[model samples]
Target: MFKVLLGVSRWNFLSLTVLTIALAAVTARYQGAEIQQLQLGLVLLLALCAHISVNAFNEYFDFRSGLDLLTSRTPFSGGSGTLPQQPAYAGVALLLALVTLLLVIGIGLYLTWQLGGKALWIGIPGVLLLYGYTQYLQRSPLLCLLAPGVGFGVLMFLGALWALGAQLTAGAGVIAVILLLLCSNLLLLNQFPDVEADRQVGRRHLPIVWGLVPSAKLFAAFYLLAYLLLALAVWFGLLPRFCLAMLLTLPVFLLLWQRINKALQHNADLVPALALNVLLVHLCPLLLLLALYWSNTATV
Candidate 1:
């Protein structure tokens, strides 16, 4: 059971779920909205199940593509390397993903019937994008990078909205959309190191397609944009004043940018993986702070 769980790649799947929960809770709290326990539990279950499915499917496919052939892939390989590098059977992982999909489809279908158009039309597609992301688009042009942002905006927000059975405010929805694009761009920059290996397997990532200089510039551009959005998120009255405290993340971001820039100049592999981990740690707390702030402010 533990091995199977590890095969699912919690960092890729579960981390997003945790991030989503925090974002939704923050949005709700700022509005003084009430949260439901039963609903939140179901939402979380759906997120985890789908996340695991994506990870498993990604593992199965990246292996099929020979992406695990690259050495020095540890410390990062973006989570799919574990099963494939070990020569684990994609068949087993594929089956697990299917089981998770069916379970979620069942729950999502019920939620749709009970909840209506938004859940099915909006929510399900949000979930389905994870498939397009890992399975197909991860190798596309800019699409590879853009896909994650769309998932962040669509899947995370829709999931939270569905879970609460509440209509999302325009402000919260917009904030989530910007967050999605910003964070997704951050994720793309995170893939810079894997570009070579991914290309060796015909993955053609943006960083690889554009080359190091362009990729690094694009990454730096987005990194700045992300901070701007965080600021705007506070200035616009969408979140509490304390949310501005996320600015404390700036120094870390600058450090990462410098690292990535240095890596690009020298064509080093360490920057992408190290930078991504740094970003993850930086953002997780900001999201959690927002969530906790929301929880404290909730009407109960």
Candidate 2:
């Protein structure tokens, strides 16, 4: 049952949120701000709950809408195969989503009260994205791509800094933007296999709205822009020079793009690209974190 719950929550993808929040908190440390360990832990917990809630919510909706029934369950793209196989899990998934959402609300309120309304600005949209995304936003082509990026990248990143009582630095802002693009591109790539399934259920995601060929090109462009943001951030002294080590992931990024482009028609072939993109997303930010930590260690 716990394993089934993990599948329903798509727990693997939760690292994207965790790593970005860690980057923000680490950036706060690099900026010489003191972060309370308790506060940071709470914020991390809040992020995890929010991510879990979103995943479970998506799973519940997808199962009910029959989208999960139609999708070819790829490790990266399909709704967790849990509910489809064990329909009994549907209620459990929905209950967990709601319970976590309430926890999100409680945490958001506490953070807002402690940190001021800046936290409120982040919380409202975060909740809406988690709740409305499957039901509303996924039906809109533009928001389908933009909402996840903004929620996971910009809001979660900035929210972590604010919660930790750190001023948002220029470096933090640029990293947040990079995360935004990475996450957006992540959604775009994952949506490729789900295009037909999504379309059947009235989801107007990029792949469905713009033919897969054009969507693939757009995904490639977004991937490049993420690297561009990293480069510009380093050039302008917004990030430590060691941070340029993020470029080490370039070969994987390029190979992933090539595979994605070539596999537009081959569903099974696209899985490797999806797997590679997941690695790139996690690796790039993690490398940035390590670079900053090492640079800090060296300076001391």
Best by lDDT: 2
Residue-level lDDT tens digits of model 2 in 1-300: 898889888998888888988987777777777888899889999999999999999999999999999998888898879999999889999998999999999999999989878677889989999999999999888998898789877789888887886777677777777788888888888898778888899998888888889988888787788888888888887788889898998899889977876786554478888889889989988998888777662211
* Candidate 1, 227-275: lDDT as tens digits: 6766676577655556556666667767777777666667676646474
TM-score for each of the candidates = 0.86, 0.95
Best by TM-score: 2
Supply the TM-score for candidate 1: 0.86
The window of 10 residues in a row where model 2 has the poorest summed lDDT is: 291-300
